[model samples]
Target: MSRVCELTGKGPMSGNTISHANNKTRRRFLPNLNEVTLMSDALGQSFKLRISAAALRSVDHRGGLDGYLAKAKDDELSSNALKIKKEIAKAQAAA
Candidate 1:
């Protein structure tokens, strides 16, 4: 899989590596991505996702996966995550 944060849609960013002699070299700054299994309270299921460290903190701050997904922008989510978000919404609505 590519080095991208599934939850945040964070990908490698292009930049420059400056040397002491003021030489600039092209470089890529990648997000701190990790594979984590997060639980959904609404669906009572767990899903594994590759996400950034910042996104992980946001997930916790929002109370969990369900909450974060509720507030997340649809375009930022991967297809798999979008499906889970919809399922959680459906389950919550049915409850």
Candidate 2:
């Protein structure tokens, strides 16, 4: 897989790496990504997703990611992805 956060849609960022001598070099800023097995409630199974730390935080900030997975485990959007639509729905309900 590419150096990206599939969950958060985070991709490589272009930037400059400055040296102590005031020299600058082109570099890429990558997100903190982890390969984790996320549970899908709808499919009654677990799927792997390459997600960034920020993305994980976003999910966690809204109550709990575990709760979202638990709720989704019983739905058809259980595998492959946690499902953007379901997450939006949950967020709206909480609001």
Candidate 3:
């Protein structure tokens, strides 16, 4: 799997590593990602997603997986996450 956050779309960023001699070297700054299992009450299932720490915090702030998916921008989410978002929406509409 790619090093990308499923929820926040955080990915590896390129930057320069500067030395004390003012020499610069190419480097990659990777996002702080963790594999987390989030449960969906509506679907009665759990999803394992590789998400950034920031995204995880935001999900908690939003009140859980459902709330985060409901409020997240579709463009920002991964294809898998987008599918879950659609399902959540359908479940909510039905409820």
Candidate 4:
């Protein structure tokens, strides 16, 4: 998958690196991502994703890695497990 934070919609950002010497260069800002395994209570299984540290912290604060994911909506590609995760993430932001 791409280097993106699924929950926060964070990805690589390009910018200029300014130096104290009044020089500028190219720079890239990448989100703090971690490979995490979220569980799907609905499916009684687990899945993984590369999410931002903030997202992980949010999920953890709401519950646990798997606990939160246990809540997203099930659609075409959104399996019961995925839906649970999405739901939990949404709920976290609202809170």
The model with the greatest TM-score is: 1
lDDT of 1 by residue, 18-63 (tens): 9999999999999999999999998888999999999999999999
Give per-model CA RMSD: 0.6, 7.1, 0.9, 6.9
Weakest lDDT window of 10 consecutive positions for candidate 2: 70-79
lDDT of 3 at 18: 97
Model 3: CA > 4 A from native: none
The list of candidate 2 runs beyond 4 A from truth reads: 63-95
> How far is 32's C-alpha from truth in model 3 (Å)?
0.9
Query: Which pairs, if any, clash in model 1?
Result: none
* Model 4 TM: 0.62
Q: What is the overall TM-score of model 1 with all chains considered together? A: 0.98
Error of 3 at 59 (Å): 0.4
lDDT of 3 at 40: 87
| Tens-digit lDDT string for candidate 4 (1-95) | 67777655668999999999979999999889898887644445566767788888877786765554444223312243355566656665666
Per-prediction TM-score, please?
Answer: 0.98, 0.62, 0.95, 0.62
lDDT of 2 by residue, 38-78 (tens): 65443345657788887667667655555544444333332
lDDT of 1: 0.95
What's the best-to-worst order under TM-score? Answer: 1, 3, 2, 4
For each candidate, the alpha-carbon lDDT, in order, equals: 0.95, 0.62, 0.94, 0.65
